[model samples]
Target: MELIQNTPELSAYLAASDVIDHEHPLVRTVAATLRADASDAYTYAKAAFEFVRDTIPHSHDIGDPRVTWRASDVLEQGTGICYAKAHALVALLRAEGIPAGLCYQKFDVVHGLIAVRLPGEERWARQDPRGNKVDVDAQFRIDREQLAFLIRPEFNEVDWPVLFAEPHPAVLQCLQEAVDEPHLWQTLPTEL
Candidate 1:
């Protein structure tokens, strides 16, 4: 699928903000550590992707109730649903000067992930740092998508193609207002 940026400017994807807060000290520290292991932007992106994917546990998958929306909180508290995990991964990517954005898919509910444009690439690749289950496995790859969930078109599941520089308001508002994972599950968006 072709990825469309909400903003025409590439800088928008790299800029730090309240959600994708790459400029935060913690994010920078993590980026520096990941950078030490990487010789180039793509290598650093792979390391960062693996860092979030392997290190952080998806709150719902682990039966953790805590809700986190921001990138730093996902890193600090160590738990988040898909959207929060995407935020963290995006921040880490941006920290290394990669252009990253948010994207979504709908299954039983809205699933969040991120897309990254390597320094000179004309296209972006979608990645799921939502962690893995014995059943659902996701991987980082640019040539093809290895997202966590496959859409069941018969079930009316859809992939929202419009990529954003920030979280979708509906998803962000739900995450912000949710008190816990249980609360979040009850209120998670069904579509964009």
Candidate 2:
């Protein structure tokens, strides 16, 4: 599917927001550590993706009750759901001046991921940083997407094509209102 940018300005994807919050010191520090190990933007992007995917345990996966909405909180506490992970990944990518945006998939409920326009690439590649499980092996590849869950059309799951500059209001609203992970899951929007 062709990705559509919500904002015409490419810079919007790179800009810091209250949620993406790339300018946060903790985000900067983590980005610095990842950047130091990476030789180029691609390596850095891959490294960043791997760092979040491998290091931070998906809150639901670990059954952590906390709910984190901001990118810095996700990085600092090392636990978050798919939307929070996507926020953390986007913050890391934008922290390094690489363009990044939020994307989503709809299953029984909404699932979140990120779309990155790598250096010099006009096309946006969506990557799922949702922590892997027994059958879900998400990878950082632009050529062919390595997302966590494949859309099962028969089940009515959909891949939303719009690449958002910030978290969708429906998502952000629920995340913000949720008191804990279980409450968050119960309240998750079924559609974008």
Q: Which 10-residue window in model 2 sums to the lowest lDDT?
A: 141-150
Off by over 4 Å in 1: none
Clashes per model (N, Cα, C within 3 A): 0, 0
State the lDDT of candidate 1 residue by residue for 1-192, as single tens digits.
898889899899999999999998999999999999899988999999999999999999899999999899999999999999999999999988899999999888889999999988889999999999899889989989988888888999888888899899999999999988999999999877
Model 2, 1-192: lDDT tens digits are: 689999999999999999999999999999999999899999999999999999999999999999998999999999999999999999999999999999999999999999999988979999999989999999999898889999999999899999999999999999999999999999999987
| TM-score list, all predictions | 0.98, 0.99
Segments in model 2 whose C-alpha atoms lie over 4 Å from true places? none
Question: How much is the lDDT of residue 162 in candidate 1?
Answer: 84
Per-prediction RMSD in angstroms? 0.8, 0.6
**RMSD after Cα superposition, model 2:** 0.6
